[model samples]
Target chain A: MRRTPPEKPADYLPIAFPAAMLGLFFVVPFAIMVAISFFERVQGGFYQPAFTLANYGRFLSAFFGEILVFSLFLAALVSAVCLVLGVPFTYLLTKLSRRVQVAWLIGLLGVLSLSEVIIGFAWSTLLSRTAGISNLFVALGLMQQPRAWTPGFAAVMTGLVYQAFPYTVLVLYPAFSRLDPSLGEAARTLGASPLRAFLTVIVPALRKTLIATFIIVFIFALGAYLLPQILGRPQHWTLSVLVTDQAIYQSNMPFAAAMAVFLVIASLVLVLLANMINRREPAS
Target chain B: MSGRFLSRVFFAALALFLALPLVVIAGVALNEKKTLAFPPQGLSADWYLQIFTDDAWRAALVHSVLIAASSALISVAIAAPLAWFLWRRVAPWARIVQVLGLSPFILPPVITALGALSFWATIGLYGQPWTVVISHGIFFVSLPLVTITLGFATIDREIIEAGTTMGADDRTLLKTIVFPLIRPYLISGFAFAFVLSLNEYIVAYMTIGFTLETIPIKIFNALRYGYTPTMASVSVFFVLVAVTVFGLVARFGDLPKLLGAWDEGER
Candidate 1:
């Protein structure tokens, strides 16, 4: 049961600042962005407020279609990789002592808050020829010689996965930490093997969270603007990278706004779906 | 037993994987040559020194700090009241307001960045540093909003009742009680927004373009031309700042609680 606070004249006072700021900045900008998406792009690095579908029509082109498909595929791969690795890691993290868990949490937070630019630079160096791990492999006679592995698809995937891994763990942390340990113990007592107990108990228990986590990570990866540009070839560029390029380099504001509008709607739909799944799950 | 051993190995490998890039970057930062290389021919602190001494790098660092600090203040300013209002008053519209506060972060940052870009352009405030500051402040308000809300929830209702019985009004009680209690949450929230704003690239880039060079924008520009050990040094510096900030948060704050881990005492 919930009790509503009594309506007071002063109640509106505290909310005034937030409403003004968000309304003026966030709401207004997004509205403008949407409106601009419908405008026509003119020559000489400008656009007009005239009605035109040509911007949205660009989406039908093979170039835009290919980029969209690649973006979706790459995002799916990043999310799947994060989920596969993050779930078991988070589960194991819960099994650790409190002090160890805090340390791990700190590490995760540190990585999570780090700028994408730094991560991209770090990965670029790590995957570079002169200082790359391939050199270590060569030293151990596992490979013929050192070679750079970046400026390609694998580099982009690795960077995105690394970037997303911490987020996945953080989102799953609350649920896993709150999970009832007795359920697993009971399964074990019923002659289930350890892996079987985990499969039958833990995985099913967190199914909703897993689904939501998958979609959330999917959304995050889809909007990776920096990593793909830094690590991947042009063909591997995600829609986000292309959006920045078009908006900045190509100076095509209308087309860029249209693409961004599409990205926002897709992300919005996925987020709503995740929320729906989460709401469906009974409160712990 | 094998399963346990293998799992341990996997976890170790994952940890190594996470640390490897940072370690490599640190090594590259210490290299003698200007090239981004490990196993340096000789050690040199020149690149690290260069971050402070060089004009472009130094200006970007200072600019990033300025934006981060002011934006963090603005974030707390916007979030504190809204969260306080929600805690003190529970209207139906409270949920809508809360959602609005969080919306900037929930969507992809690129969307938010584009929106800010167009808005600034429309208002003829494009290419202004203040625009980036405000955009970042608004963008990261969700951080402090969540933290301060958590702070308010931890305040026991009985305390408010006791204060009222003592004839303390809303203003006095808030000043004496609520403000003192939520100070740590406020600090943590500020710290979060500051560090993130410092690290943010896209919003800052889109709003102000190259007119104002933050560290990320500077790094991206440098990366476009070529790699340098100086970039690695800056990367190392950033990692240190992130680690130190988060390490303090872990030490002084209820980090697990902040992260939404279930109460241990309850279990």
Candidate 2:
């Protein structure tokens, strides 16, 4: 059956409703944020209407620079860890029976539903001196005493990685499941060891997916606000924590907006890059 | 094979790592003491009872439910029409709309929250519950958009032609054909958005703050000021809620398809 494309009048209602909603709520606000970043910070925790580059200039400080660098590093680390752990787990997942796979997928979805705040505190309790892994170690005679591990980098990383691991698996699962098992079989028929066949065949095949997963997880970890604040010390606070601190607590909306603009730009670039990679290999 | 054994061991250990914190929280929620402990001094449901009976926790629970329900409705309302239009006609403007709609979610919540803060303040809507509702609706519209798009993909073109041959208008076709076929996706999308909004924190904090206390914010404050078994109990409540919602989606809908794990093209 030949069908005609819907005409202009018909298109107006569908396009206009969502467009208006997004424009007013999403795009315009971002524009306003960018505009506010240029406004002057004035007395009494308010900003003046006068245009200035003062907020962006404040980002030039070494302290803000350190925070931004540390955030990128932390996000990179989390993404790397998720990829390292997720790839093998997903590989094993694809090898499972269909029913078992569904069960595990549902379990991962349930974990993914947990809010960062909840995960952070859950890990904090798990890492606390009173009833943490250290206590288990002591019970096993592996340690002399329980140790307080919260408000530290390791604890923060654990929380962030736990929050991100599900995402990494979900993202990679579709690609891995779609892969032909015969590819590995074909390699093994040529006398390649199982490890060698996997490394040489599957690893190369999922290269783009691996990079995409890394960037996705990296961006997610970069935007983390509650986790770092809950699980780590002041020095470990990410760029997100600083943005909220400056905006709400410090009452420096302009500076906060400026930092936020920077954060958005960084995220935007990574997302666009990922999109491009996905486009380049649409099948993957 | 050694490789198979290694994979099994590695997967088991990682799964345990993922489940450990949740298991510990559930254990601690049964503590008889105020302080959190794993080998709880004594097992009791006092913390759970406290969550159910305490005024602050009860109010927060109610508020969270209200906000999540409203936001999920708004998201599906917006996403349904948008998905319908895009599926019917692949207009250039539709591509732009799709990007704009989904970008809020792709970008960090902090950025969107900052934008919402500035925009709401400018329009004098700050500290209002509706601001958070609208913000969350925009943030999570992507979930329904993706689901509904997949739903639309499943409709055979011939079915649309058949409806047209019967002289059914677009609205009639949608009501008679599209809605019924896409109903599960719509429900799944709603459940997805509801669960996510329940878990959302930064945007809620930035937009509504103390003006309205949602569960996440309440739990966050509790954790920051001090650790308590009450907070652990709240976390348990959240886990249970998430499981229940997703469980329904899995039971009634195609969870793998909703997750985009199953390719229609392949079939």
Candidate 3:
């Protein structure tokens, strides 16, 4: 009687309200995606209900697997680069006066709120094949137009870094702010250099934020489509791009569905593993 | 450390990185020549005129606005009730309900898009803008739910106790005190959801099936064919709308906190 509450319509109504609506929207959509992957396309591009593993087998294909590998490697690289770039910037922001902190926060917020597509478009112009920033580089004898900057792996990496950098900085800022000012002061008083104190004291304390920021950044970067699709070499496509290419350009819905499934699996595995490791250790 | 010197250099670099792209885009938009060249042949907002005149581009902008506005409303309405339930119920299932709300944000959008596309296709709900709104809405529902949850926690429990002592039931208390106070959080949540939905491309592009294009689809198409003067203008337009919308939200809401700030107590 203590364990279970009296049955009343009002008691469960609130919890049940969202459960039903959420079921209709989120779970059902995922089910359809999975179900469609196993079906064949009929005449006129309509989905035909037929059980098949042909779609799932495409994941083993060299072409699809290659793109997935490239994306994973690139995503990992960008995540690292974002952390490297973000930590210092976040440190700088935290050290600022309150008004300055607010100002700096505004800038970070602006970038965070800016869409992935906007960043992609802007970066493309700045590094366009011809008659753009790369062209300016050529005119100044810096590099040539139709430069190796855009439409390649390097460009995609750059864009992903730019997109994820703000999140990294924002996440790291709090960790940095939470640092004890007097610890660094005491270290300096005891003859430790600023850099040494930072490396020993500040860095260790930031481990949790570092992990959290990295996971969140990785999640966003890995799933990101626009930056890679625009800037990446078609041959060096991200899984997100591959999924879109298959679904939209090739009209290979089955193959696309397969790619989307693999993408989610990759993300889920990483998130679960990170959480497990974090829970076990408590901190790095 | 030469703190001031290092800070200045870092900040200047950041500002340039943030500003240069927009400056280049805006400059190219004004180029009298057809190509998107900087140090333009001449300056004019002719490209802006071209943006307004382009039927496909204009259609996409309209679609983006409509989808964003409607989705924000829908997400907020549903998330509010769900959050209220979770806060009041405190049952075992309430935790599951919160996770359900947040799961979409954690899950890859591509996977979500795929599922949504398939789901809609099977139901023959494809090509309808409402489908896009609902699909994005479910994902964005988490935003309002989070805000309202935080607001609920922040409210002075004693004030609500006082209200209850004054003969307020849950419904009356919600109307008299809870709703009025958390209104800012609610508004901010709506704005964030609306802005993000407007700017979203991958989901919009995949689910819309080429029958309807958003501003992002137009910019994407423009990139594929060529980066025309007009498209540069479109980029400028996007930046402006993004800046204004984001500026308003940051002004009214805890933008950094939403980005997962750690030192909110100090701020």
Candidate 4:
């Protein structure tokens, strides 16, 4: 073998600690839990290390299928909602003067800066009865009572939309801001109608960014914790919530690991698919 | 004109939607009534005071800060070397290790939580504060790494040569030149990791369960039993802290540059 050139070395001690931490705390424990799922519980919540897919088979439970489908629906819904709300502003912001663009960027940065937990707490109070600004519909005599927003599906949608929209907007903003605006204007000057110009020229220009935003938001909504935790009812759970309940409450290590593994696999698929689609995108 | 109107309304509604929650949480914190209420009957600071007197809340708050600071330091320490590798190494195994280092962070929290839960259990480190700090550090590794990488990438190649010709070794060049240039970015990245670790509830929850609760977990538990005005007071306190921190950041740092979404060189 040819000799390699000498170089300045990286600090192995620094990387070692975190890698070991991930291995010990994150990788190994999950491995044990996954291993346990196959065997029936023996004692002290420990299962004799035995291999069977029977526990995985239990995922055929109607609840598992139902939750999985509902989670997909919610993910798609949240992604679509964020896309709808995000696209126009991203376009408009890009079109605006730089000063205005920075103002909006700063605002979006603030929203994204706050933690997801705080965002959940904030929305819960906003939609809660009596004082929730949403409840003002009742006070104004537009409705009879404060809509049962939280601990329900509607609130789950609201929370997911809230959690992921800023991300969608932030990501898509750059693609829009850096877009070649003259192309769209040229299309208009060439006698294309406004909608047609947008549809044909602007749409294709934005196609990759939209796809990236959609995939990111969908995966994010799929794995969301606090939004659904605070907003959704107990039975109407996301895979994240369901896995959490299983691990912490039921102490069903194997089952929880199974669900968590499923979530990871699903996220990986979505992200990879997005990457493939993005790579296939043509130069604008 | 209609398109402009539509766009304006879209952003207006979005702004309202984002602001609404903070407003209510602050309002609820001021309720004079004992139970958590909307349209609180009157105003009071009792709940805010309660946060000070409550021992459990105090302990959780202290725990959160300690972990967040420790985790930030740990993340920076880890990131520095990783950034060095990413900046220098192009070898295949080196690349794989790089991805592995970031996998837990780039992936979702739920997946990381699941992995960490199992990872911690076997090592008998599952519920310790150190475990929480370590988990947090792992989760936020990419932020500091990316920031420092940016800081490193921006350093003109000639500067390193300039130092080397002055007879400086790698260590001296790094300490004397590289560190000073990236220090602000390092601080911002560290702050980002610190805030995120402090606010992260799910990882802490799955790993720690009730063995120890961070302030967010404590608040979550409190809400499960029943919402209290004191909870609102805590929310308000967080807002105050955010405002105070941002104010200091504005004073000591260029807010726009720190965010990393834009460049200082850009208009």
Candidate 5:
């Protein structure tokens, strides 16, 4: 590698602004949150500075434990479903013409950038009795009546899957596009069926990418807050939803902070694991 | 051939599945009545018009735009120099700085939002609109950091060398050569953060709460009460904004490359 000239003292000046901003906003706040997580909850829904593991210990209780377990399960399920559907779809997408690919990319980006609030709202409407797909079934004589599907596990799953599908595709796009087409062709020449070729050859070859994508999607889905509230019953709420409810409605900032801290640590570990896997995957 | 036909059908079905909710929302926005109906009891643009005409909804729209525009600008401002420093220097701390800049985005927004929520509350800045702007600016800094880094990577080393050889100073080289090259990247970065910030809910809600009625907050508050065609209309409007911004990015920038596709030469 070519060596550039040495930096001057003034070169450090550019970094100072962002450093200050992030340090003040990001670092300080996280520190405060960690501190608050250990603080004591006082009367009247406020908290005071103190050392206590009570907030974290509450996570061991049935209610909080259930939410934590359910959050992880939902995230894992969403990730798996998205990868199963998205991997194939993205691979097929790469085979299309560039113009068509760009159009699809735009559509995906639009969906990906859209607010969760809007998507939850849209799905709620789509799953409602008046505007839902069940109405179409009723119109075609396939059903006797329209049906409202919100406030259920299936509805929450559908909303989250829809929200996560775009991200899954976007995350997997580069890997799928970069895949050497001749590998599949070679498999085909060996008398392997197409499905067999995909199963045996392509899937294994991209295992690391697939794993990384799964973890990324998992982290995203685990943090879903609005969809559960809008589409599911209170019993189906995720940790994120509970965190918000605790802080805002229940006015328990200490517990909310503890949950948030746990979420951050969990995400960081998964991210590190993904990084290790990617680093070890002999750079293609 | 049978397998190929099956794959095509599968792709078409998935596309329809992806589009179903969006199509439903659009249909519902056109309903004449207040009730949410897909096939439309009647047709009217009144709800769409009401987004701008209604006081609460209009205020929310203005607040969303304000937060998005200012936060995007702040993001680019912070991201540009940080990316430049990383590109220009080869120091160990540069990597750490990059990680710090990117960490807010990589972690769940809820964690970052909670942190910001507490941070602001501690400093007595809670519920302030500018807190939302600054928090989002820092949180979404990774967008521009990635794009601008990509921008710097695309800059030819020889061009900078030539400028230096021709007696141009560091300032001149940056102003003439580097700045012009990265302009598109900066704009795309701004656009990406703008659209996302405009549509963001959790962070905005956590930081500013209901004090500033961003479109997402307004919609959520409204939903807790009941359904409104106006909410659907705003959603449709959001989709249009997102699509338009991304379409422009695709047209003006190398969309595939920005999206992580390997370069044509590399392939």
Candidate 6:
């Protein structure tokens, strides 16, 4: 269409509705959370209107520190595992025919659409003693009996990885598919093994994307609230679980808000870092 | 040959691992036993039947459908025009508007939920279904925004120029040329938003509180206390909904391009 003149005052009308909606519901709530994090926690599981740094101070305590550290460690682990498994898998996907690639992509989107609660409990059942993969182990004489895998770290990691794997694949697919097939083929013709060429050439070229995906997945895993509660022990709870606990269960909204503030800040930083990396590389 | 064979085996195993839990949940829903079991003591449709028969499950299903439908409608209503404005006119604030639309999606749902919870409470609108509808609509606006932008990319500039040279106003042009061309994307965006809203839990739980029950909240409560075959059946229902929604999107739209994996000059 011919370019419409920019002089129409009506040009600005469409932005008004969505802008106000986002401002009120999205930006305003975040502002409230920030303000509430500075409020004082009171007796009887309530918060007072006094200005205080106590909530932030609470985050500096050994207990909260441990929770934060463990959450970070778990998120890092999940991202690493996703990268390890996702890289090869996406590479293989790129090697497939376009029809098969589309089919796999559709299947992945279906899995990705499944809610965390469903994914969590589905894995819980799969790892439960009565009908778990352990039973298959027993049936095949790989082990003597079924074993409960829930209420443990491994099971939690399993669910996290399963949840994150599709995302990892989706994020990496664009980059991997855009890669020149001739690059690897040329490397092979130059007398390097296929595996060796991938490790040396392709992996290095994709280093930025790998890091970006890792940070994206890491931040996502950090915000995970339901998975730990569903699949792991109390010690396995992430900071998100603690935020909900302090807010809803313990009625300590200030503490919960404070923790959420830290969580959001950390996530924002990582997202910004990923954006920077993407800007530098432009491919991802 | 050996290396390729090994790689294929590894890929198949990994694919199976990715799919195992979901497949197992569906299978367990077929169990005739009261308790969940893998081999499913005997095949039956009773559990799936329970989703419709049980009052709480039925209510949750209805509530989820209403919320998702309304949210998708609200999202498309807001995003469609905004996308058109940004695409057609060079506005100074367009980048800011785009960021505002997408920030909810990029931010953690927990943060958005807490914010929405507090924001709604302040406005004395907490625990209302409309709060959830609005919250979800805003949170997922990015999906439609992106889809609609891609839809705009598909419009030929020459056709647009020809329409303008015919003295058609922007409104008439949008209605006649742009809307028809972008109808698939609009539908795809709505479906994408609907599916996401249906699957979302935290924002719905936080904004609406416990007063209104959505399927995810009900599932969370059930899973917390204990596991039941009924819960598995409910999950099966969700998996089916997701499959149906995404399948439709795939059937009608460019699923891969929609997912941000388009090749150069392909679209």
Give the true-structure RMSD of model 4: 3.5
lDDT by residue (B1-267, candidate 3, tens digit) is: 585676689789877877777788788788887877776778888888877787767777788889999988878887888877666654775677788788777777787777777777778877786788888888788888887887666677788778878888878988989899788778878887887788777777767857787877777787777767777787777667766766676677665555445444644
- lDDT of model 2, residue A76: 99
Docking class of 2: medium
- Number of the predicted model whose DockQ against the real structure is largest: 5
Q: Which regions of candidate 4 fall more than 4 Å away from where they truly are?
A: A1-34, A37-39, A95-110, A113-116, A184-199, A282-284, B240-267
Off by over 4 Å in 6: A1-6, A44-46, A282-284, B263-267
Residues B22-66, candidate 5, lDDT per residue (tens digit)? Answer: 899888889898978888779999999999999989999999999
Tell me the alpha-carbon RMSD of every candidate.
1.5, 1.6, 3.1, 3.5, 1.4, 1.9
After superposition, the stretches of candidate 1 with alpha carbons farther than 4 Å from their true spots are A1-6
Off by over 4 Å in 3: A1-7, A41-46, A138-148, A178-186, A277-284, B53-55, B262-267
Reproduced native contacts, each prediction: 0.74, 0.68, 0.51, 0.38, 0.73, 0.65
Query: Model 4, B1-267: lDDT tens per residue?
Result: 786677678778888887677777877878888755677679888888887888877788888889889988877887777666556445445555556556666466877787777777766677776787877887787778767777777677688778888999768977998788878768767876776776788888877866887877877887778677776777667656655554554556655444443452553
lDDT of 4 by residue, A77-108 (tens): 99998998888767766677655665655556
Model 2's i-RMS, to one decimal, reads: 1.7
Q: Worst lDDT window (10 residues) for model 1 chain B?
A: B32-41
Cα lDDT tens digits for candidate 2, B117-149: 999998888999888999999989999988998
TM-scores (chain A) of the candidates: 0.97, 0.95, 0.86, 0.84, 0.96, 0.94
For residues B1-267, what per-residue lDDT tens digits would candidate 6 score against the true structure? 887998899888888997899788888888887878887899999989888999988999899999999999988888888788788877766778888787777766788888887788767888977889998998889889889988998789889888889998778888999999999999999998998888889989888757988888888888777766888888888877887888888887778777767665752
Candidate 6, backbone clash total? 4
Candidate 3 achieves a global lDDT of 0.75
4 against 6, candidate with superior DockQ: 6
Q: Using lDDT as the measure, name the better of candidate 4 and candidate 6.
A: 6
Candidate DockQ values, in order, are 0.69, 0.69, 0.50, 0.44, 0.71, 0.65
| Worst 10 contiguous positions by lDDT, candidate 5 chain B | B88-97
i-RMS for every candidate: 1.9, 1.7, 3.7, 4.4, 1.7, 2.0
